[model samples]
Target: MSTGQTRSDRKPAPVKMVTTDTGRILRISPEDESARAAVAAAATPAPQNIDPARRTDVLFRVRRAEGHELSSWWMVGAFVVTSGLVIALLSWVPYSA
Candidate 1:
């Protein structure tokens, strides 16, 4: 830190433009410009080292699907059995002459 210069003493830093070999102009911070330049040189990956044949197939188990279907059927069957029991209990009565 400089004793003579404080943050309050300085106006905002000016933007900088850099020209690359491809004729592209990029605006960036002067303080971080060197670090960014170093990164750009080594940032590219070797295409030959990457295998383009890689693929992914996501599959759900057929057994799990069937089990879920059976479970839903069982739930409906339970509801029917419960309703039948309730009806049978309500209809129960003793006949007296």
Candidate 2:
């Protein structure tokens, strides 16, 4: 799944291809105004202005139980009850005469 901008979406920038002595080709973007602006925009961090009330609301919604959904405590209690019943049944069974 692509989450951000794709290469095909952006216009291809003019680049200089230089061959090194080690037979390696390097594609370098020109240090122009547009290139500098693009670099600056990419380097800039996104603003994060989170409201405490909004955060609490989101957290509450996440923790809120829906209909037919069992809580962790209920599941644990059921497991403990089933285990006790199994143990009691096994103890009552006579293995030897």
By lDDT, the best candidate is 1
- In TM-score terms, candidate 1 sits at 0.27
Worst 10 residues of 1 by lDDT: 50-59
**TM-scores vs. true structure, each candidate:** 0.27, 0.28
For each candidate, the alpha-carbon lDDT, in order, equals 0.63, 0.62
- The true-versus-predicted C-alpha distance at residue 23 of model 1, in Å, is 1.6
Q: Estimate, for each residue in 1-97, the C-alpha lDDT of model 1 and write its tens digit.
A: 6779556766777887876533357777878778777957856644554333331232442333344555577889999999999878777755521
| RMSD per model, one decimal | 17.2, 19.3
Backbone clashes (count) for model 1: 0
- Model 1, 68: alpha-carbon shift in Å? 77
The regions of model 2 sitting more than 4 angstroms off are 1-69
**In model 2, what lDDT does residue 82 have?**
100
lDDT of 2: 0.62
